[model samples]
Target: MKNILRLALRAIGVWATALSLFSAGGLHAQSFPSQPVRIIVAQAAGGLVDILARGYATELNRLWDQPVIVENRPGANTIIGAEAAARSAPDGHTLLLSNSATISINQFLYKKLPYDPERDFALLYNIASSAYIIVVNPSLPVNSLREFIELAKRKPGEIAYGSFGLGSSSHLETEYLSARTGIRMTHIPYKGVADVLPALARGDVQMALAGIQPAIPLLKAGKIRVLALTASVRDPLAPDVPTAAESGYPGLNLAGWFGFVAPAATPRPILDKISGDLAQISNRRDFKEKTIMRGGLVPLLQPPEQFAEYVREERARYSLLIKNLNLNLD
Candidate 1:
């Protein structure tokens, strides 16, 4: 009789525990994002990442009926914002809006990072990607990528390239090209992209790696000529320009991407919900058009697992490149 009573009590306890877990999960699924969501942008306002984050926030607000705020925490090559996001509560209320620089490149550029790129955060979704166009002053005689390469080879170190900053995506892309093609060109670092075009126009720097959106008007105005794009395919905005892959350098394909992430311990249901909403937003025609108009590529939406894998690949690629080049900012 005692043995039977003990077994019965154990069975009751198991059922009660199961019931409590299910009830808690249901409550969590139902009440998530009960307040405003905050997205920390790792750059200053008015930058490309900021623009995309604000646009997405507007759409999310419309969908969630709650304010979705974008907070700028720019500095330390995005480490500041990334660290903030990594430390936030994993309750779906806080997120990060970041670029390849923060998620991939910074880990290698900085000697020591405050957070682990892989272990500290959960990747929610990739928002959009944009390719860089190799722009040169029209005064330069080079028309094609091959011709540009020949020119650089002839004058190795004479043709200077301007990048936004040291260890920035622009700088790394240029370095990657130099490593693969054996083309040597002097690197000129600027305070920001705003300085790159001016330096190029004044002939202070003859060549640059810049995104197509900012380069388009200048190209149209005959201020700059595009030698090649960093994407595998030519940009629709500039159909005439060939990609680096088409120009006999298949390894030069690189692009800048934007994405969202939350702290790693966020619940699976919350992640799924956020990913679903983001995928829907990415597919909206207006969103696509606006992003393209602003010089961003349409986003390739992926679930959390797939996005995490992509981030891992990028992190590894940049890590190797940075280590090989001995690139360090701090």
Candidate 2:
């Protein structure tokens, strides 16, 4: 009878402790956003990612009636911003605006990362996704993808392609295509897509994988031709261009994405609240027009856990592709 009484007391103490913690979390959620919320952007100012982050911050501020700031931390492949975010308190006041390369591919590309993508952050929502385009110089003598592949086979290393940088997504796309087709071409790395397009126009390079905005002006000037796109479905802007699936290489249809992440230990209530608020805002027409359409991105918001699984899948996919490319940025 004495032992039974002691066991009951211990159980009551455990239950009381759990209830107190639950109550504290409830209080935290009620008083959430007691101060300014910082959305750290892991890219340079004036870029598409920055624009999107600011747009989202504006909408979030409208919802909470609180100051939402976008802090840009641009260098060292997003490690600087990511580390800052990782070290922040998990009180739901801080978030990271992350991109595809930083979240997915950086793990394998670098020998050491300041913060582990999966371990340090919890996925909040995927903001947008943009498909890559396969553009070739007008002088390439190939109007279609198959024809271009045949020419690359005929010329071997004589055919060269340009990319923004050595380990950029476009470079990986070009390298993977070369791997799948069993073709060899010299890689011409450029400072950015701005440089790559000009090089393509002058016949300095044969082909490149670029997002729509960078390639549009050249396509209009007749400087380059877009033989194919990477969208699973046809892009509304360039419906005439065939998709990579139509071109018989679905793997080439990789879309770059940007999304929100918070420190991993953030309370579930705060995560759900922010996610729900953001999803409603993302579905609005004006936000879509101003941000998504202008930047050639499709608004793609999903639940946090679902987005987390998607990130894991993307990481695994990029792992193989990066390995094939032999990219060693470290």
Candidate 3:
């Protein structure tokens, strides 16, 4: 009788502790955003990530009836802003508009980051994605994807390609393409993708993986020719451009994506609440048409668990690719 009573007492104690924690978490979720919330963007103010952060801030502000600020901390390969977000308080108020660079590629490139990608953050959702199109100097003899590959093969290490920076998605994608096609090209590192377009037009570089929106004006002028997109499907903005898969390179369909992440220690209930709210916001037709489609990006909304898995898979994929490329920024 004594043993039975002791065991029952311990079970009751554990149950009571769990109930208290659940109640506290529920209260935290309900009372979240008691103060202003801030979203940090690791890019400049006029860039796509900043634009998305500001647009979402407006919606989030309206939804919570609280101020939502977007802060830009661009520099040092996005380490400045990402580290800030990682070290922030574990409350649900701070968010980071993270991309492939910060979440997946950085760990592989740098020997030591100020923060651990998996340990310091919990991903909320993969909000948006865009494909990089294969563009070449119009003066180049290539007019199609297959033709470009043939030219690259004919002139190994003779044709040069430009990338946004070392270890950037553009860099990795171009390298990955070379690995797939068994061709070699000189890599010219540009400060940004925007800068690469001018170089292509000037014939300083023969080819590049460029963004469609920024390349549109140059394409119209016939300065740079877009041969194919590094995507699975055609972008509405460039309906005539074939995806790499459609162009016979199914393995080259790599897209760049951005998402939201919070400090890892944030309360589970609060994380769920914020994620749920953002999922609802993402589903709105107005938000989709205005903020997402307006910028020529595709909506990639996923729940927290799904997004977490996505990040893990991407990290693993990048890890192998980076190792194969033998790239280490540090």
In terms of TM-score, the best-performing candidate is 3
Comparing candidate 2 with candidate 3, which one achieves the higher TM-score?
Answer: 3
Q: What are the TM-scores, per candidate, against the unseen true structure?
A: 0.83, 0.82, 0.86
The residue pairs that clash in candidate 2, if any, are none
lDDT of 3: 0.87
In candidate 3, how many clashes are counted? 0
Error of 2 at 75 (Å): 3.5
Ranking the candidates on lDDT from highest down gives: 3, 2, 1
User: In candidate 3, what are the lDDT values of residues 1-330, reduced to their tens digit?
Assistant: 999999999999999999999899999999998999999987666656777889899999999999999998876567778999999999999999988888989889998789888899998988888788899998888789999999999999999998766777778989999999889999997655556788999999999987677688889998899999988788998999999988888888777788999999998999999999999999999998888877768888988888878888888999999999998888
Model 3 vs. true fold: TM:
0.86
Instruction: Judge candidate 1 against the unseen true structure and give its global Cα lDDT, from 0 to 1.
Output: 0.81
Segments of candidate 2 deviating more than 4 angstroms: 136-143, 146-168, 185-207, 214-225, 245-251
User: For model 1, how does the per-residue alpha-carbon lDDT over 175-293 read when each residue is reduced to its tens digit?
Assistant: 88887888899998774455687789888999998877766667788888888988877777888888898988787877778888889888777877888898888877877778644
Clashing pairs in 1: none
